[model samples]
Target: MGSERNEHPYGSLKDGDKISDKHKRELGRVRSSPTFRLGTLFTKSVEKPWRLLWLPFSILLLLVQVVKERVGATPRYSNSEPFTGESEQRNCVVFFPTNGVGLGHFTRLLSIARRMNKADPDMEVVFFTTSPTLHLLREEGFAAYHLPGRKEFSNMEASTWNSITEEMLSNVFAIHRPKAFLFDGSYPYRGMLNAIVRRDDILRIWVRRGTFKKNAPNVPIDSFDIFDYLIHPGDSVEPNIDEDETNNSIIHCDPVVLLDDEDIVASDVLKSRLGIPEDEIVAYIQLGAGNINDISSDISIILGVLHDAGVWAVMGESLLGSRIEISELPNVRILRDYPNSRYFSSFDFGVISGGYNSFHEAIMFSLPCICIPNSKTGMDDQFARAKVAEDAGFMLVEENVTRPRMKNLVSKIIDPENRQSMVESGNSLRKPNGASQIADHIARLIFRD
Candidate 1:
């Protein structure tokens, strides 16, 4: 009997004193308790509409906290003082080369101002430039303040910081007390920043174009502590010497290029003025802006090649009087104060003494150039630039121009195969519309509220 009872599957109940239905019912009730029901309800609540609303609210709260922390974390440097919100409406003046020495600097400055105006029309951009170049800027509908006197290379050395600073500051303060002042070129007038810094209300920026050449003698570093920023558009070309570092400085802005509708239109007009035939190939020859030393032999060599290829030559102001003998060449034309954009575009090729302005302009216009560097004027840099361009398959005249070399290079560029290759290379290397990128950087730095 014991063995049979053990074998039975329901053997655990034994004789359960009383097999009561009430005990079984109580066990079933225990499994359905309120605690388990409440747990299920809590999980369903997480998927309800109220949870969705709270989730977005929590995210918004997190974003607000992050932004507030970021704003607080920004560096509270002394340089930031001049760019405060209270000075937003104040005038911003830019002083650039106005004379016809090289329109490159002025054109680049103008392009920046135009971009600034487009970004914020309320901001004022005043130019304190030379008289001769004033007409060029005015023609483009820019409001500029023309400084008295002409640009004289003979007096360039004598135009010292002490003398020019007073004049520059006087002009700037007289018309409008600018909140920000910008200057172009390597040497900005000395004490100009000191005068601006005295006010404590102005920000001054220097737009430097040239890079220090390797192995060259060290140039004296100018003290620009009074200025808030020293913007190097092509700063990456070389590491700046420690002596050149400014105290209140912001570095690294894109290099400026002047490319606008007005510039294009003016260039087209210049092409017609220079008698450049629309269909024939044109070559622009510039022997440094207004610094031509000897041109008769140079022009003769250029004319010989142009005559052979039927290409027109557009010469700049420097070659004006030098072209007296070469004027007899039917294909040669002299353009004084011609718009650079038109002059650059009028040419399929350029024969230029290597200068930053002309080099960048040729690259900007995607024109092939035969660069003949003027070694006599400490322009050894042109040789390096020419070599780089030549390595990239663009035309280059070996340094120190000789009649035979000029003629040979000109002939090579005129050849359809060679010219086509140069054009393609230029198109590949061109960095167009850099001005807008520069402007955007400046606005962010100076006007970021």
Candidate 2:
């Protein structure tokens, strides 16, 4: 079977077909005629009587149906408080950061949580991530809970997993009683998004990023219409917020990393904490957590390049004890923490992946960077990210990162003119602390503005 011959939207014009000027003129004349204009308006005018007659009846029926459903369903408000203004009510904004492939999702949510708490100190911000990194949140004066990853439950029976997840979401809703739920992931779990709607009166906001790498895994991202607000914490250097691609109701924010200057340790403090020497030109290396997408293959080469250039490399705990000879070299030491963005002051330069949290923090802290995008992961999307920066000439980016490429890029970052160009470019972008701006958006929704 094939497409029908008359399938063209305008007409049956096929390849190599041309419309005569007379035909085009006739079509244009009819479209521009007062008769055709009046015909369209007349159609609308004729429908007005039916619409006026039935609209109120339809609204009344909807109201009655709502009353009927509420009679036996869960109460809208358990406190039995009468209808009041938005100011009187303290609302909670629940956040779901998906699972822990890397710390990007987790740290971005944590950043938003901090801003939300500060913006409306009275309102509550809750987190439900599958990562056990809630200890980081507790240290930051926020409350959070963990949900088991889908992979854990996916292995078992579907019926069993559904029942358990449904129950878990129900309990979360009952405990939190959120005014809104914000999700940050490519594929938000259906059970979780549906749970918010089931609870009723909860706005669902999605913090989705985009323009993935060619090889990025395809996560099931369907039913986007269910969300009330689709917030894109957009990249600083990438034109990632394309209207043609994303759905309506997208709220775009700039550089939504966990950037609280108060959390940034002084240069001496960070060095002392990491036990890096004062004489060493320490280079921070974080190619993501390496839990899902391992980029440790080039770790030895990268560290060797930096080491040969008289720079001690700092890494996360993932590569520290992995017995990689290069990472375990005398000049390399691990940062031993999640949300290592706070320790930006510790390093003179950085070799970072294009993960949202890592790259933006490097830009935010003005660290001259050589970005090696980790292209092998479940929606890590580092290759596309690095491509954007490289194309824009903002940062030194590498996709197929070889030892020679690493050497060249590292040397480029070391040059004063080139390093200053990258630093100035990053500085010229929208400033950090988009977390506060996002919090303001949430507050506006809560206040019914």
Candidate 3:
């Protein structure tokens, strides 16, 4: 029967013989397969060793990966603080009121710096400014450095002027190794300016008094990079252009006015001393400290207009040198060297041109101003800032103004309804207590330790 024929391994019998010859051969092969059993046992034994090794190895790899990720994911903090130990030294310094220009920028910067110094005694603030501003700072009992500036006004070509200014900057930076430098204008001498800043490893800051959209047309915005930080002196007025139009480096701090509690007290005293009646409207006319020749004509026109409205003029320092005599006008008061703070509150209204001090102080006092922008005298920024103010309902009078136009504008501004509207608008726009905010920002920047 096929040798007891083996049903094929464990299956039922097939058709004819219950198991064919092929089935018999398969059963014999199975009975003889010790080699296959040995091979199966060998493969299983090999897999067991690999599995034992892989479990511990995979666990070790996972632990290493986790530790690596933990180390790699740590956050980075800025090491802005100067060295404190024997190996290194730490210093903080600021540059304000750059030489050979308007006192307004210098005065405003000085005011902010003074506030900062009062708050923190440890900081070192170096003022690299004109001799006149430095003298004023010295009188205030602040340490200041004076850079020798050219007093003569000769129009030199741009290339020649640039070289001269660069040399001047090199000399200034060599004397003062400041860690941080602050310049007032939007456009400064970039070649010399950047060289000094870069060489000293200083973090350069630019105090942009106002927006770039208004300044870009007149100032060289394309030539220089946007400042590391820009301090706008007014309430955050939206720029006229898209955000993409400006370089993204600027950090806009609050507009800074130098007036504080002492200044306010002094202003009150001056108001009382000047016999400026609290009830009557008093207008301060500040044409600025520089360039009386270009703005004098407009000043006469504005004065004539204010005189007609029965508004008193508290003329700024520029009036002292003006050829046009205001001595004849009984209502107008020539404010020669009055404490700036005291004179500020003496006015119910402010009719001034663009200067950092007058603009900010007027806002600080909540006084409505009819801004007559005077550009011919190196103040190209006045018109642009005036435009922003005008859009917000402040009155605007252009330079080289005529008597009739000035009179008409002043008459309208003095009108009860007009004056009320302007006052309300000014109050809405004024961020009265910004000095503390500015001080805090500066403190944090200077003292991160």
Candidate 4:
């Protein structure tokens, strides 16, 4: 947490140091026009003259004002400082989750927030997200602010969308004045960095799970300097990538899961609710949320195997993408559920992709699953995560996925002894969910007397 402000673009300027041309332009442009409402600096400035000589004097005056504001923003909290209990009255923490191609980011943050609130009932948690699953948040009784991603707007340039993000997110901060800010995503957006600049009042945190491939692009080093803490949720296999000193306090915890074992419904009750026969064996299938119509898709192959093997199937459909449609297949049901781990008890085994959330959930729940890792995901090394489980004899990984191979794996998984062995192994290796540990840490930081 004792990071140098020099690493940031807006870091303190010295007597001999030169101001970057970009910040000067930003100050001028934001002052001259009312549209650029990024930080709290809203003072009006004179229009630029036709003569270039006036530029130096104008920049000098603006720099003086910015320096005064920065001084006010940099007030350090001393140990002897009296606790006013101001934040307790507000008692809010803001969570920002990027709308990735999947719901991994949103769900992980949700898991943490839920634990935080449960541990401290007085804490009010709010979400500021680009995720389309605001309805899901509301159902969980948390207020969420939504901003559509750049892809959602037709013909809008990325810069313009970022400007909108900065303006809207800044407004949210003004309204809530949250005690802390937590973001879970691979890359921190420019707008996010701009809006959160010099907010020394709020404890800023970033949650980044690792398992990236070698070719993955690195996040900006300067971006890492902006946060007070970096929390890395652990993976089954520690990623092969090297970790650098990002100058922020880093905390490593066990894998985060949304639901505990007690949260799972009883198998008989869950089956009855789904209109499934109590005597039937069920397999839960959740590949990715890609195009389902492709006949050669993995889901199709798995479905064919299940049908032939006479096993009932419950397919997990995601809430983010388009609805999955298929002609009626007997004894096959489609469950469009959020945090599908709640239903893990009803299924005998799972055929799931090795995304962070699903793979971790399967292991935590002791659900014997055959993991088929998705190779195309940007940062998550799904294969590496699955290989760790496979090597530990807790699960199986089928990389090539053929009908014969899948059928054989499915048959092997459903055997009573094999399933029991996998379950026992996973139970031995299981760790307490990281969400509670993170939640308690946050409470200590914000509520310490």
Candidate 5:
């Protein structure tokens, strides 16, 4: 645990006492006497002339410390490798994503970074995160740093945690000296803000997906001013709530999916890999990580329906959660792949939650899906997003899901003609992958400038 290593007297101060315990009683009486009070007042009167002289000196020392930090002073962390900008590599970009209930924020930033790298092979990409999934980023061949979440600390103040965040991130910036820094999350941390406060050399960007509920608590308005660019990943449905237009230039792009059309695994290849016969009817079920709400009952009901219908079911296990316990059956299987959308085309149809990434991915891939929106989220209006797809004949929405409703929907979706109609609607409404477009924009802003 970091507790032993980070043990500091942050909350253990005792009025700056230095007197020995043995002499404390006599000292206390002398301090409390009227003579002591008179002496203190006399001393203060005598020191008044020198107060102005010492105050300026103290303020000057504080100013010097602030200036040192603002000017990219040496990082305080032992592992820091400060960037000297003398290496052959340049055009670096750093991505910072907060660990959400699932992989929403992390996947979005990873998608953009992938496209950017594909476009500019020499562009250096890095990651700094509090998410526990550092292994996945390393698997993708990206350099990443990790900071444990504030909850990991025992009885530490939020301010202290943020100070740690600031130091760690500042060290990363010192090492990479990125040309641009992108953050993908709803709320930006104070530590993150402080880390980049004086880094005018880099372009600050915010990649915030939009679909927040009207009454939900949102990111602070002034926080938007800190970024030079804000990219709003478009939603399927236009939100009914009025959006404030006063923030930094908001770059509205189409839904950002991780994989492009060519990137999707061939249906035959995917099916063969999963050991499914070519003739079997397969359904893919992917609720979220089951962190914010219980999804076990829902999964059980869907599995039962599929089993009854003789449909081979493959459940997507979230990387953030422990393995789900499922009753072993010949037709049921579990997939632990990150970016499950690569195999979306292999499924006959899907039963998925209405998250921004998965919802748009199902549409982008033309996979006729049943959108079982998770409405327990703090801000996402999943029902609204699903309803838009439903209205457009892209898919069906099951808000209060049950066996009968799921079975009926499954029966209708399995019909060849109905499935084709849904596929056509999706194909007709599909936008070009927004991840590549955003990558192009980033290139133009950083490389071309």
Candidate 6:
């Protein structure tokens, strides 16, 4: 199907023309015309000066269009009523996928938003998120509205969190005036869902990921009735979507990841940026932030094991000193950025969490990984994902990677035979990232495609 989409050349070639019948016909005879081709090339070469003269003007026009779009300059009625007749042109798909944890939800939403923009640049694909990592979106030239999110849930009460969530949504929606609101999370907080239910003009779309641990008692699926549609991003390559096949509101999609292999930072670039020597074998140890999983005590053990094995260790600053004090280890380096997965190619292998983003990136990048699922998370579905990775032989696991266990596993994992199998298994994944599917569906609704 992807090959067909590529061959068809309509969607893939956004903002550019594809091979038409005229082009095919021209190529047939043009191949025989060396002199005519030469003349045409000569004429085009002579016209370069004129083209150059107009280049600045072209750029200026494009810049004006972009600025106009960015400011929401078009005049429209602000009446508390739905658009009817010909004035119902949708300009944006406001996304609310921010989380207090890692950048998984934001990155996944970004992947889709970017795709949507590529398809229709006029459509203002905006982010109404609570993520403090707005700089990440800004760097990519995306407009995002900040929401006051509680980073730590240690002392937060349910009622308090609900109120905060509701107020955040209400404030953001009033400002952006979005035609559609895409909520990407396991449970849509009562406040946001209630807001969506009360609005007739707004199209509520739920972007939920599945393969949630069976033991994890989630909110009843009936609550999802408030959404007009549910985009369920599957966990496995060939996941059995039949279990919830009767849910008419759900549109199943492939697993979503921020970056594919091509987006990986070059090994040399990564090494230079991180100040690591070219020849050193690196293991990126990320057990996730303390809010997700508290593997503080085990960080020292993993680092010690890697150090003894003559391997360098790299970790996110959030992971270092989470559980306990981190000493000045010469071999351990801290990554201080969001979506650290982009630099995944720089490392030789990984010690990571079994969350969706981590698991997807490990396989997507073909990294030899030892995955540790967070058993304490009530809403997390890491164990199921870890089982998939284990069956594929792409991942090694431990309930709690103790000092002794890590030391033994290191030797077994780094063995040439097992490492080769792990790498091969990672490379065997055929599932797409499903970003385009999300973008396309929303684009159809937004642009009436």
* Candidate 1 C-alpha lDDT tens digits along 35-109: 443443455557685755566555565456445433433211122122121212243545554333345557667
Candidate 3 or 1, higher lDDT: 1
lDDT of each residue in 255-371, candidate 4, tens digit only: 898899889978887688778999888998888655322323677788888888888989888887677776367888888887888989899999998888888899888888999
Against the true structure, candidate 5 has what lDDT?
0.76
* lDDT of the candidates, in the order given: 0.57, 0.64, 0.56, 0.75, 0.76, 0.67
Q: Write the per-residue lDDT of candidate 3 for residues 1-449, one digit (tens) a residue.
A: 00111122222233232224224433433533444434444566577866555555555654564454334332111112221211122254556565434565675677667776677665556676644545566776666655444444366565465446554554444344344667775446533442342232555666655544443444434323434555555533554434354553555555667665456654456556677666677787776664444665666777777877888777776422444355577777767663354556566677777655667666666667777765654434566666666777755546657877777677777777887787677665576555566566756654454
**In candidate 2, what are the lDDT values of residues 44-135, reduced to their tens digit?**
54677665555556556545644543342321212121112122222677788866556667777777888777655666677777776677
lDDT of 3: 0.56
* Candidate with best TM-score: 4
In model 1, the runs with Cα more than 4 Å from the true position are 1-91, 96-101, 146-164, 167-171, 213-222, 235-244, 260-278, 318-326, 343-345, 376-380
Best by lDDT: 5
Reference-based TM-score of each model: 0.68, 0.73, 0.65, 0.80, 0.79, 0.73
Question: How many clashes does each candidate structure show, in the order listed?
Answer: 1, 0, 3, 0, 0, 1
Instruction: Compute the lDDT for candidate 6.
Output: 0.67
* Clash-forming residue pairs, model 1: 267-342
Model 1 alpha-carbon miss at residue 330, Å: 1.2
lDDT of 6 by residue, 1-449 (tens): 11001122112211121223224323433542434434544466467866656565655664565455334342111112222212232455688885735566777888888777777665566787766667777887888877555545677776577666665565555445566788887655655654455455777787877666666454534446667787887675344334453344777787888776677777887788778899988888778766755566777788889989988888866522343355578888877665677888788789888877778878877788888887776566677778878887888888777888898889877776888888998776647778888878876665453
Report clash pairs, candidate 2.
none
Candidate 2 lDDT (Cα, whole model)?
Answer: 0.64
Candidate 5: where is the Cα deviation over 4 Å? Answer: 1-89, 239-247
Better of 3 and 5 by TM-score: 5
